[model samples]
Target: MKMLKEKIQKEGIVLSDTVLKVDTFLNHQIDPQLMQEIGKEFAARFKDAGITKIVTIESSGIAPALMTGLILDVPVIFARKRKSLTLSDNLLTATVYSFTKQESNDISVSKDMLHEEDVVLLIDDFLANGQALKGLNDLVKQSGAQVAGAGIVIEKGFQTGGKEIRANGLRVESLAIVESLVNGGVVFAEESVNK
Candidate 1:
């Protein structure tokens, strides 16, 4: 986690008070070593959760989620943002609003992927407004699966997402929590704690 924090400090771009772009080493061009470490961290944190499956939304969430799944030796399932012809009509669907994209999309998961016996661990690159996680959780619920918890690579603590998800009784773990991105500066929650 310290290495991740350092990476953010060095390469992350502060776009605004509400936006911190980490595409250099995270979402866009990836650092495999860092992602492996992150996967290890999540596996350690959720080691005893009896996770039967790893769930995530498509795009940005896939990398970390795939890494986590590899570490956990569990199958990973990602929700598709757009319905495709290859996808069957028998699916669990949920509408999610992306605060960053300023739009909503209907995400879906095939019913065959999840089951009532599954204990799911949700993984993602970032947690902003919690909409994506909510939608994924809804899909899991529809499948009668139990949510083991969630592991997030970066959490915008200043936003309502993390808090709201926690309040909903989901065990959430984040590697780097940004307390603020005020005035183009990154302030981490751990830094405040260490102070």
Candidate 2:
């Protein structure tokens, strides 16, 4: 986590008070070593939760989720943002609004991948508005699966996502939480005391 914080400090670009871009080593051009460490951290955090499956969304969430699944030796399932012809009709769907993209997507998962007997751990690249996680949670609920918790690579603590998800009785573990991004400066929740 310290390494992730340092990476954010060094490479992250604060586009605005509400936007921090980490495409250099995260979403766009990924650092597999860092992602492996992230996966290890999440596995350690949720090791005892009896996680039967790891769930995430397509694109950004896939890397970390796959790494976690590899570490946990569990199956990884990702929700597709767009319905494809290859996808089966037996699916669980939910509508999610993207705070960053400024659009809504109908996300879905195959009913065959998840079931009532599984304990799911949700993983994502970022947590800001909590809508994506909510949609994934809804899919898990529809499948009658139990949620273990959520693992987020970066959490915008100034936003309502983390608080809202926790308030909904879901556990959230974030590698690095940004308390504020002001004037191209990044401040972590723990480092706020030093300011």
Candidate 3:
């Protein structure tokens, strides 16, 4: 988590008074070493939760999800942002709204990927409005699977997303929580995963 904080300080951009852009190393262009460490940190944070499976929203969340799955030696299941014909005929699907993109994506997962006997841990790159997590959480509920918690790489503390999710009584852990973004600078929360 210390390394992630340092990377954000070095490369994360404050796009607006509320949005933190981490595309340089997180969304678009990836830093493999940073990603590996991120996976390790998630594993360490959620190690005691009895995680039988790892879940995430597609596109952006795939990297960290896969990494965490590898480190934890659990199966990774991602909710697809778009449905593909290639996806098996039998699947579980849910709709989630993206606050940043200002749109909704119907995410889908094959039926065989998850089971009622499993406990799920959800992971994502960012937590803004909690809508995405809501949808993924909905999917888990529909499958009759237990949700262990949610793992986030960066949380916009100014926004109510992370707070609302926590209010829902889910254990949510963020590696970095940004208190605010002002005049192209990032203000971090007093409490971080490092703390």
Candidate 4:
């Protein structure tokens, strides 16, 4: 986690008070080593959660989620942003609004991938508005699967996302929590004893 914080400080771009772009090493151009470490950390944290499957949104969330899945030896399922011709029937769907993209996407997953007896862990690159995680959670619930919680790569602590998700009884483990992105400076949240 210290390495991730340092990496963000060194390479993350602050576009606004609310936007911290980490495409250099996270979402776009990924650092495989960092992602492996992240996966290890998440696996260690959720080792006892009885997670049967890892769920995430397509594209940005896939890398970290795949890494975590590999570490945990679990299957990873990504919710498709668009319902393809092959993914047409018996799909569990939810609407996710991306504040960064300024649009809503209908995400879907095949019903066969999830079941009532499974326990799911949600993963994502960033937690800003909580929409994507919420949508993922909804899909899991629709299948009657238990949600173990969420693992986020970066969380904007200044935003309501993390707080709201935690309040909803979902355990949120965020690696790098940005407290502020003001004046083009990235301020990270102080590490808590509980974390």
Best by lDDT: 2
TM-score of each: 0.96, 0.96, 0.94, 0.97
Give the winner by TM-score: 2 or 4.
4
- For model 4, residues 1-195, the per-residue Cα lDDT tens digits are 899999999999988899888889987899999999999999999999999999998898899999999999999999999889987688999999988789999999999999999999999999988999899999889999999999999998988988998999999999988888999999888888126
Tens-place lDDT per residue, model 3, 36-58, is: 89999899988988899999987
| Residue-pair clashes, model 3 | 0
Best by TM-score: 4
Going through the candidates in order, what is the number of backbone clashes in each? Answer: 0, 0, 0, 0
In order of lDDT, best first, we have: 2, 4, 1, 3
Any runs in candidate 3 off by more than 4 Å, and if so which?
A: 192-195
CA-lDDT, candidates in order: 0.90, 0.92, 0.86, 0.91
Q: Alpha-carbon error at 116 in model 3, in Å?
A: 0.8
The global Cα lDDT (0 to 1) of model 4 is 0.91
Clashing pairs in 1: none
Better of 3 and 4 by TM-score: 4
How well is each residue in 1-195 modelled by candidate 2, as lDDT tens digits? Answer: 898999999999999999999999888999999999999999999999999999999999999999999999999999999899999888899999987888999999999999999999999999998999999999999999999999999999998988998989999999899999988899998844212
TM accuracy, model 1:
0.96
